[model samples]
Target: MNPNDPKTITDAEWRERLTAEQFHILREAGTERAFTGKYDKFYEDGEYMCAACGTRLFISAAKYNSGCGWPAFTKPADDETVEEHRDTSFGMIRTEVTCGKCGSHLGHVFPDGPPEEGGLRYCINSGALEFVADGDE
Candidate 1:
């Protein structure tokens, strides 16, 4: 993606596409409940994309069993698909990951992951993702 890409949807489009709660959480960087996300028990071969911008963020192959009460991924589908920011909110220093295309806040990334490849855990919110199962219409 280009460095000068626009990172938001039109106001009308956002209003039409999402509910108030979804818009607040996905677009405004709000957080959802710990175990209330949709993808916490998701186990399928597919791609996880940003609900706001449809940007492919994680692949089924990259998902792992983190047991952190959330869907975990060891790596993103592509490095550029998600952008990381230094989040100092909530009185903690964490790396926040958001969709690069629309800047929708998904969740945070942590270094205390399995000692496998990448060695990082992308703890994501299910409200921020849409799973497209493999070979589904």
Candidate 2:
């Protein structure tokens, strides 16, 4: 599937392409346990892409340990790569981040973050992403 146009894929195709857990989080807007994600503590230099559509969402340079129990980044690789929406679930108002290509739920973006760095925390799910090491890409 082309990362630039994931909406072309049908729901059945998404179910067939992703695992149960991935489908739950990416498609159903579910979240993984805090601090349990594979990339929560991962600090290797790399680029993080949308697991479903392979859209480049973040980079190692922007990744930071915010003690938020998830992979946090100061910013995405490009603003256009992610789409933010006002989420009002669970009695809380928050901004939900999704892959611009496929509209898959990645996580949320919070205002609390290192002020020195953009002051935005991109709390992302590892299951929603796939990493490609700097040199391996």
Candidate 3:
């Protein structure tokens, strides 16, 4: 690992950097209850960043009303910003999305998105993201 890599951050340090909810969702791969997230119904122009490592993940324009009870995006701002892995947890087979910089769990991706937007939905947890509204950069 590289020096000062976010992935190398210790749990104790993370506790100091994030709230209990954020640590649970980002580090423990926990999910917030559907429709309870702050960003679920948020619609503004800007970027969504990883709550843990602050890595830019999605753009506001990609957001859509998937009615999945969480914030949904058509695509990531950049494919390299996130990493996908085969997740078989909770007795289900799914693709888990993680932060490329720190390996924090964001959420899962599904193939049932809007067809005009390539048919992929990045179902993310609100606790896993921080929204930076447009012009607030």
- Alpha-carbon TM-score of each model against the true structure: 0.89, 0.95, 0.97
User: Which residue runs of candidate 1 sit more than 4 Å off their true CA positions?
Assistant: 1-8
RMSD over all Cα atoms, model 1: 2.9
- lDDT string for model 2 (1-137, tens) is 66547787877989999998899999999999999999999999989999998999999999999998999999999969999999999999999999998899999999998999979999999999999998896
Considering summed lDDT, which 10 consecutive residues are worst modelled in model 1? Answer: 1-10
Evaluated at residue 63, the lDDT of candidate 3 is 99
lDDT of 3 by residue, 5-38 (tens): 9988889999999999999999999999999999
Q: What is the C-alpha local distance difference test score of candidate 1?
A: 0.84
Lowest-lDDT window of 10 residues in candidate 3? 1-10
Which stretches of candidate 2 lie above 4 Å from their native place? 1-4
lDDT accuracy of residue 99 in candidate 2: 96
Please report the TM-score between candidate 3 and the true structure.
0.97
Best by lDDT: 3
- lDDT, candidate 1, 5-26, per-residue tens: 5454566667688777668777
Ranking by lDDT: 3, 2, 1
Rank order by TM-score, top first?
3, 2, 1
Tell me the alpha-carbon RMSD of every candidate. 2.9, 2.0, 0.9
